[model samples]
Target: MRCLLVLPLLLAAALAAVPPLLGPTLPPGTELRLLSADLRTLHGAWRVEGRRLLPLSPPLAPKAGQEVQLLLVLPGEKPRAFPGMAERGDVFLPWEKEQVSLLRLLKEVYGLAPPERLWP
Candidate 1:
């Protein structure tokens, strides 16, 4: 019976490691490339505001904890490839100066903001 208690804890940890990316957590115009997943078998990709990826009609849906590479195409500069992961439907881009602008936009759009901005 000891295994019963441990089961829930193990499950929780696994889920926590790879949480779903939900709408409102991502902005439009985000580009993501799947690293390891079956495309043909997978139907329709995730979209912003629950939008789906295009060019493939049903874009490749990102799975929680799925590995991905982020291509941040900054203006006047070559697109930068950054390592990130998929959560929910959006890829979690690592912290960068550009995120400051992203955070501000999200605040205005969602009326919710990350507390990190409030401190210092």
Candidate 2:
């Protein structure tokens, strides 16, 4: 039935709109949605203004074999994540390559807008 076909499409669309849930819900205004085994996003980034990100939720500490993914959402493009690891009970995300890259991208939106770099 046409209804059956449309139902799946609607469900798929809705699922795409939702972000991934790993640890405690990340602080408000930030969501890390797992897109697949290798892709993900920080949904609702349009609300960010680029500044030091302080998590409102408890720190993110991945269990063994797990890693935290941070993705950047650019206009007309998909979200991007910097790859890194956070051991359990670390209490903070390390400012490593992936974290710094993610922060640089976010800074374009929330932190003071820099003109030298391009973000979209």
Candidate 3:
């Protein structure tokens, strides 16, 4: 019946309307790993600017990976033993190659502005 078919469609729409769970913003120095990722090319390397990591040069695409690591220089800050999730706006510095790249979470209404970068 048309009503039955529409019911499924309505359910699907409702499910689709649900927004994704954007995980909490990970603090600076949170070490992340590159389990899997996509390659991106940028003009320059990443550096810490205030509380955010902005590129010295214009960003080509974004050297974003599925996971990454963060390094902190403060006292009593050490890497974790177990693995966990990395959400958007998480900024990480790549000390070695074959690792994930930095992240600048942009979660605004327009999503055009970059989120605050977390650095130690």
lDDT of each: 0.41, 0.36, 0.34
* 1-120: candidate 1 lDDT, tens digit per residue: 999999999976854443222232454444333343333333232223333332323345556676555443322445445455556544455454322122333334433333222112
Off by over 4 Å in 1: 1-58, 96-120
Best by lDDT: 1
Q: How does each model score on TM-score? A: 0.34, 0.28, 0.22
Clashes within 3 Å, all models in order: 12, 11, 6
Error of 3 at 96 (Å): 33
In the range 39-97, model 2's lDDT, one tens digit per residue, is 44321122222433433333323443345554534434555564444333221234423
Clashes of 2: 11
Off by over 4 Å in 3: 1-22, 29-40, 43-53, 61-105, 109-120
- Clash count for candidate 1 is 12
What C-alpha lDDT does candidate 1 achieve relative to the native structure?
0.41
Please give the distance, in angstroms, between residue 61's alpha carbon in candidate 1 and its true position after superposition.
0.9
